[model samples]
Target: MALTLTCERQGGNYGPACAFSEILALAERRWHEWFSQAPAMGGPYRDQYYYAWWVLANNLVAPFGQLRHEALVPSKKQYIGVWNW
Candidate 1:
């Protein structure tokens, strides 16, 4: 997912290989911890998605220029939903 995001950035280009698995793993762990503590959310993975975005935003420090053409820009809207929680 990290690789996909970077690739979706403007004028980004994918490398021969990238190390994004760790990011996804970390995101999953964070989501589990969050939901386990916040049972009111009543998961079906909604909280997980939001938490994943939060983790990505907080940790992904790579520049847009370093991403692949298919990579996505981190949009304000994308960050709003999770951060509000």
Candidate 2:
């Protein structure tokens, strides 16, 4: 079984259409560009290091409403609020 899910802001115009493969390729390219800047970690913990960075990036939210700066939420599913500390 396979399933694909997408989300867009309510009331926002649907942007340009893209095939699933194209969308996946774009996401992969963007992830590579972002991950390329991550500091190198060589050891058994390397995978954990990258996973932590991925989690942060995945939960990052752009400034919106009262949020004046880009912020990272604790977790998109469990916690939707940002911390100042």
Candidate 3:
């Protein structure tokens, strides 16, 4: 039930090892909870779950964003690239 991720850079000194699979499972659970609790798009929940998904996708390269780091740029850019838009 604890939702947490270790800073990879911190290594073993931080705490127990967190597998990538665990992260994926927790992310899916959180997503499902949001989907179920959230109202349909353009409805009262418009500003809730839908916005949450958008933020998650854009920030973490979720499928909804349709943009990946590979297409963005090798180096950080001041603005989002065409692929991201």
Candidate 4:
């Protein structure tokens, strides 16, 4: 069994529709691009290093509402808002 889901905030306008496979491919390409820019880290912990980066990237949010700049939250599942410290 398998499940796949995509979420988007349309605000008011619904953007052009995209096939699920296309969306997945685009996401994969984006992940590759992001990983390429990351600092190179190698060793037995290479996978762990990338996983940490993935977590950070996944939690990133664009400037929205009161946020004036892009930000990263500790955990999207636990944090509902961003705070500047």
Candidate 5:
């Protein structure tokens, strides 16, 4: 829905090639074993099936934090949840 449109509106999509690169990096980084900071998500043979859905999150773009990229931009408004997505 919004993602399909948002990708288009952002000048252009990240592209299949770039996207594949990201996937490969995810594999090389062993995200299948440990995807996030949550210890529950980490394991020796974590199925990681549900982890795929994490991409649907606005987790990448932000002054807010998620996963590895942690940074905060001060502002009066508050982002309580994924509502910003």
Candidate 6:
């Protein structure tokens, strides 16, 4: 996933092989976790889509540009959801 994001930024060059870095591994873990917890909003993975955007915004886009995109605030749906929030 990390490799895909960077390669996309580079316009599909896919130059170097992605190293098995800890951060990349963590990102993958979080992605899976988000999918697992998606049932909180709806069973068809509706909530997961929001979190995927959150991951791109918070973890990838903002950090890459070194600018504040927005606060990493969880929406009310998260904490108040029926599933594990």
- Pick the lDDT winner: 4
Model 4 lDDT per residue over 1-85, tens place? 8975554546845466668888899899999999999999999999999999999888777754667777778785766776454
Tell me each candidate's TM-score. Answer: 0.29, 0.67, 0.36, 0.66, 0.21, 0.28
For each predicted model, how many residue pairs clash, with residues at least 3 apart or on different chains? 12, 0, 0, 0, 0, 0
- Inter-residue clash pairs, candidate 4: none
Cα RMSD, model 2:
4.2
Can you list the residue pairs that collide in candidate 5?
Answer: none
lDDT of each: 0.52, 0.78, 0.56, 0.79, 0.44, 0.52
Q: Compared with the true structure, what per-residue lDDT tens digits does model 1 show for residues 1-85?
A: 3534332424555555435786577668877785566435446987787776555545434444554333333454545322121
Off by over 4 Å in 2: 1-16, 63-69, 83-85
Off by over 4 Å in 6: 1-24, 40-60, 63-66, 70-85
Sequence-dependent TM-score of model 3: 0.36
| lDDT by residue (tens digit), candidate 3, 1-85 | 8966653433336565778898789878877886677556776767776766655444443233364542322223375534443
Q: Against the hidden true structure, what lDDT does model 4 obtain?
A: 0.79
Compute the lDDT of residue 17 as modeled in candidate 3.
73
- Cα displacement (Å) at residue 54, model 6: 10
Candidate 2 residue lDDT tens string, 1-85:
9976453455766676667887788789989998999998999999999998898889777653667777778775877578654
lDDT of 6: 0.52
lDDT of 2 at 41: 92
Worst 10 residues of 3 by lDDT: 68-77
Q: In model 1, what lDDT does residue 78 have?
A: 43
**Which lDDT value does model 3 have at 83?**
44
